[model samples]
Target chain A: MRATVIHAPFDVRLEELPDPRIEGPGDAVVKVVASCICGSDLWPYRGDPPVKQPRPIGHEFVGIVQEVGFDVRTVKPGDFVVAPFVVSDGTCPHCLAGYQTACQNLVGYGQGKADGGQGEYVKLPYADGTLVATPEVPDDALVPSLLTLSDVMGTGWHAARSARVKAGDTVVVVGDGAVGLCGVLAASRMGAERVVALSRHEPRQKLAKEFGATDIISERGDAAKDAVLELTKGVGADAVLECVGTAQSMTTAFDVARPGATVGFVGVPHGVEVPISTMFRNNIGLAGGAAPCRAYLPALMADVLSGAIDPGKVFDSELPLADVAEGYAAMHERRAIKVLLRP
Target chain B: MRATVIHAPFDVRLEELPDPRIEGPGDAVVKVVASCICGSDLWPYRGDPPVKQPRPIGHEFVGIVQEVGFDVRTVKPGDFVVAPFVVSDGTCPHCLAGYQTACQNLVGYGQGKADGGQGEYVKLPYADGTLVATPEVPDDALVPSLLTLSDVMGTGWHAARSARVKAGDTVVVVGDGAVGLCGVLAASRMGAERVVALSRHEPRQKLAKEFGATDIISERGDAAKDAVLELTKGVGADAVLECVGTAQSMTTAFDVARPGATVGFVGVPHGVEVPISTMFRNNIGLAGGAAPCRAYLPALMADVLSGAIDPGKVFDSELPLADVAEGYAAMHERRAIKVLLRP
Candidate 1:
């Protein structure tokens, strides 16, 4: 089998690797049909997070099951499925509460020593809970959309749920990345009357508009807050989805929220300092973290299967597995919203 | 009128001041029977805040109505009442939502030209919303308990409500000052089965036990978190009330709380960096601030009126108005649980 591996900074290579086998009784091997580069993947590629050993590079994918271990019951060979980034037992208290990302015995796919979805074949643990099967094999075009259910889509759903987004809400999404764009779509699907996207890129902003953004604010700082405030008639947004993990983005989300509104932060907080005083005084609720991807994938897959939301639109560029390095480079330079890879 | 005034750090004086009058349509004048020193008062008195002018001191009080403006309707002259620290309009949007402390026209009782309860007579604005009437005027012994209802008791109630304390909850309260001690009472009243108080002061810890603290952790750092976790069988606390407004206190509160719990913080946050990443990852909810004093005073007053709870037990020191400076000094030096001054 062939897989993408990172040797060092800005160096990605598709090399021959041994085919993954089912090591645990609950594990299953999947022949990858499609995989995609994720924003989080850039972390190790940019030399930001030290990578002493060559590591598996992706987590988002849709594939066909090739083999299953003895204890696996829900999934079998020939089954088409989406594998969430995090693997959970599906029976833990946290997993039962729909927070599988925080499951006590959770396994992080991409960061673990275990092989991830970026390869021609990958090993998925806790197959019954980590993989959601589609009723039928999706078409070539629908593969991209189905592949997104593995991560970005589920994360966007988590953002909406954390914010308690509901009908008639004026939601403000902070970020123009794939997750941010999906957040706009999720907010709209959740019945938000208005969705505002804050972006600088022309193409991403246009895609955001198509994905249900009723307003766009290209400005940053006080100007951005003023734009959202003005759009919501000075009361600020009813729900703010912070998709960028920076102090400036979190502050903007807090500043643009109404007194009783909620700020859902799904962005992995990079260097953020949340002002506890401001949040307390305004009674604003802050909720969100790593999306319980496994918990939300089933429903998100149903939505995608029913064609209610086109989350696949986030894949602005598609390439063969051999060009995986370009995908990482493009995402690092903010040139691609998301890159889909055919295995 | 004779009142306590702080001219500078450690420079409190009992000086002659003009008697308060009904200056507005919604105003009332009360002849203060008792007033007390609060921990927050030390912020300015300790020279942490800029002081360009002599400031009237004290915000908590219980008194007898001496005069009322033309529009005052809730109470009449000669009626005994408890004045909440915050004076709100009561009809604003925020007030209607049970957040009167953030009322559009909210006013803090003292610290500027605003006269405080330390005077013989104090002016009360928005009296219809600020003062809670008692069933009858009680003897001098009941004065201390009733006075606490004005701020400390009500503040603790706000903390409990913010933390969403419920029956049988395992609660932890950080800070053993009057507010934290009162929080023990409040959480107990709210039906918590296990109440833990984090304090190093033996006297305060003893008072906390008397006020319904089932456990106490005197150690700081990892030991405190370990103590709380050990008490909860490694699950941590269901609810935590942060009553001290400092970075260290806030960190301890967060560290001691379990996943999916709420950390209610009524402390005026000072130099606290709210770590949102940990909060989101741990699924902890943050609620509380400034204690919507007026909103909870009515219920606390009822407890005092019916003798259901003796909030006045927190007043460990009492002095005449002539010794008002000593009262402030006692609280500033942490020598008093709470200081009561007779006008």
Candidate 2:
């Protein structure tokens, strides 16, 4: 099997690796049907110091079970499924409570013993808990959308769900990346009356609109807040979905939210400290984290199979698994909102 | 008129002052019938610099209106009412949305201009909005209970309401002060099946039990959290109310809350910065701010009038306004759960 590995900064390469096999009683070996690069993956590709040594990369994937361990019962060989970015025991208290990200018995792929999902064959732990089977093998065209269920789309959905986006809500999405675009879609699906996307890029703005943005604000920070206030007739938005984790983005989310409104943030936060005084004065509610993608996958996958939504429009580029390097470069250079890889 | 003044640290005195008179069209002068010192008022009494000198003190009061400005319509002369700690216009967007604390035209009393509540007479701003008229003036025995409505009890209610404490939910309160006792009461009223009160003091623990604490923990920090985990069979409580503003209190709130639980905090926060990464990973929801007490006033007053609840039991000590210094000392020295001041 060929796998993508980031050996150093900007050094992504396709390296041949031995095929994976089921090791634990609860594990299964999956033949990767499709996989994709993620925003966080760029951390190492862009030289984040913590990711030091060469390692198989990519956490999001849609695959078919080729073999299952003796103890596996929920899924079987030939079953097409979506694997969330994190593997969690379905029976844990946190998992049962719909917070799989905090499940005590949790594991991450592309780590140590687990085979990276970008490869042709990946070993999946807690297969019954991490994988959600589709109604049947989805069509090739539907694969892209189903694969997003592994991370980005569900990540975006978590932001909206956390903010409690309700019918007739005026929601603000404060980013234009794939996650933010998906927020527009999620807010729309949640019955929000108006969805505003903040973006300065022309192409991204168009994509945001396509994903269900009722309005687009090209301005950033204070100006973006002003636009939101004006759009809501001086009454700030009902919910602010922060898909960008920067300090400025979080600030904008608070600034544009009406008093008593919630600001749901799902981006990997950096240098963000919630101004306690501000949150206190406004009765603002803040929720969202590394999305419990496994918790949201079942519903989102159903939406995809029934053709109720089109989250796959985010994938603007595609390549065979061998050209994984090009996929990384395209995403890093902002040439594609998302890159789909065929294994 | 006599008013309680904190001229300096340990310099509380009963000072003679002119009787308050309406100064604005939205103001009304009230002859204070009952007043009390809040836990926060002790900050300056103990030498916290932000609370400055030579000012009339106390923001919690229940009074009888003496006169109303020409523009005041909702409240009139001769009405017995309760004033929220913060004054807000009843017509603002935030006020209309039940977030009076964040109203655009907000005003705070007890500092300057607005005559302090712990006085013979207080010049109330936004009289129509800030003051809630009871069905009728009550007997002396109920005065202390109604006075609690002005701040501490309302603050506790805010914590429970913010945490969304519901039927059969297990609620943990972090702080055993007046507000924490009030939280136990509020949670019980909100239908919580069990309430855990954290307090080391025997008197406060007794008060907590009276207010409906199903359990009590004398431990603080990690041990307290361990007690809570042990109580809940390691699943954590459904809601955790943080009534202590210390960093440790906030941390304990998170440490003892279930993954999907909310931490409703009402204590004046100091040095409490929520670790966003931890909150995110646990999908922990953080809500609560200055208790929108005015928004809660009507419902609470209705309950108070109907005898459905009595929040006044938190006032355990009584002192004449002239002995305000001793009142502050009693609270500071942990000799009293709360001090009631008579003007």
Candidate 3:
């Protein structure tokens, strides 16, 4: 079996590795069908977060169950399933509260012994609680869309929920990546009357419009805020989804939100100072974090299966698993909305 | 008429000022029976905030309406009333939504007006919306407690409401000033099972206990969080009311709150940095701001009138109007819980 590893800054290698097997009572071994790159993965790849070891790279995957442990009841051999990037025991208080990402037994797939979908075979614990069985083995034509539900699509959905984007809400989604593009779709699905996507890429903006972005602002700082104010009659957006985790993007989200609105930040923040004085006086709510992807995969998968939403449109390029390094470079250079790797 | 003027940092003087008259169709003139110094007044007094001119200092007051404008229909001359520190028109969209502090027609008494309660008389704008009339003049003993319904007591109640303290919640209040003590009373009134007061002062802690604080944490930082977590079976407090707006207090509030709980902050935040990263991941909802004093005064007045709560005990000192300077210094040095200055 071959797996991608980030050995150092800007370095990715396709290394051969041994296959996995069912290791625990609640565990199941699955053969990866498809996997993809993520923005979060870039943190380590760019050396912003130092790599402690040659780390197994990919998290998102849709696969077929190869084997199951004695206690695995819901999924079995040959079943096509969407395995969440992070495995969680679904019975904890936080999990019951629908915050599975914060579950006590949470394990990030492919980060450690949790070897991820970048490999041909991976062991998933708490299979009954972590993996969702599809109606059938989805055809190759639908693989890209189904694979996105593993992380990005559901993450975007989580961002929309955090901001409380309801019907008739004027929404502003900040970021042009796959997650941000998917957020536009999620906001539209949740009935936002208008969605303004802030993106500089024409290709990404085109997809954003298709996902229900009513407007676009390529400007930064004051210009972007002025444009939003003009569109909202000086009231600003009812909800702002901050999909890019940077000091500037967070500030833009708050500046473009109306007093008493919410800024849902799904981006992993780095070098950011959250201005409390502004948040307090403005009376806005801040909500969002690492998404509980497992919690949302069910409903999102249903939408994909029913042909109501095509979140897979975010994957603009696809490559064979053997050339995963090219996929990483393309994404790092901002050449792809998302890069899909067929395992 | 004479009013107290903040001439400079640490300088206050009683100077002759012209008597105020009704200036608008929705205004009235009131003969101030009582006016008190507030913690917020110190911001301009100490010059932390800009004080361009000698400004009138008091905002909290109870008085008798001496004159009414043509459109002032809620109360007439000779009516005993509690004047909300914030004068709201009660007819704007925000006012209708119960956020009268953000009213389109808002006027901050004393702070914004040339004539204020520090003088013998003050002009009240949006009088019908800002003044809550009593059926009759109460005994002199109830004056202090009733006056509090105009701001401090009502503001603390606003904090408790924003935190959503329920019947069975274990609430932690940060701050030991009049507002924090009043929050203990408000939390009890809202049916919280347990209330913890974070204070080191013996007198304020005693008052907090009287106001239904089941526990007191004299310690701060990690020790305080440990105490709260131990009390809550290592889960932290169900709700936290942040009545002190410093960065340390906000950090403490977030540290001591249970997952998915809310923190209501009523104190004017000063140099506060909210770690929104922690807040988002923990599912902590931060809600609060300038208390819509007009919105909560009615309920607090009813509670006071019915003997359901007594907020007057928070006043540890009282002084004649001429001695307000000393009262302000005492509160600034933490030597007094709150002071009532009688004019």
- Indicate which candidate wins on TM-score: 2
DockQ for every model comes to 0.40, 0.80, 0.45
lDDT of 1 by residue, B1-343 (tens): 9988888988888888887777888888888899888888888889889667887877888889999989999988999998888778887766775677777787876644358767788897888977888878887778888888878988888788888899999999999999999999999999999999999999999999999999989988788998888887766788999998789998999898876677888888899988687777876767777777677777777777788899899989999989988888888888888888887
The residue-level lDDT of candidate 3 at A73 comes to: 86
Model 3 chain A: ten consecutive residues of lowest lDDT:
A275-284
**Which regions of candidate 3 are displaced past 4 Å?**
A135-143, B50-53, B73-75, B89-98, B103-106, B111-114, B132-145, B164-167, B189-191, B280-283, B298-302, B305-308
Ranking by lDDT: 2, 3, 1
B129 Cα displacement, candidate 3 (Å) = 5.0
The top-ranked prediction according to DockQ is 2
What's the true lDDT of residue A125 in model 1?
76
What is the RMSD of candidate 1?
3.1
Per-residue lDDT over A1-343 for candidate 2, one digit per residue giving the tens place of the 0 to 100 score: 7888778989888898887877889998888899999998887888865657888888899988999999898899999989999888888988988889888888877787577878888897888888899878889889999999999999999999999899999999998888999999999999999999999989889988888899999998789988988998898999999998989999999999998999998998888988777888788999888899888888899899898888999998999998999899999999888999997
lDDT digits (tens) for residues B1-343 of candidate 3: 8888888888877788877887779888988888888888778778888777787778888889999989889999999899877788888756765777777767776665425666678887788878998888877788888989878898899789878799988999999988999899999899999999999989888999999999999999999999998888777788899998998999999999876677889889888887777876776767777787788877788878878888988888998888878988888887888888887
Over 4 Å off in model 1, which ranges? Answer: A90-98, A111-113, A133-146, A166-168, A189-193, A280-285, A306-308, B72-79, B91-93, B111-113, B134-146, B164-168, B191-193, B298-310
Among all candidates shown, the one with the greatest lDDT? 2
Interface-residue RMSD per candidate? 2.1, 1.0, 2.1
**Reference-based TM-score of each model:** 0.90, 0.96, 0.91
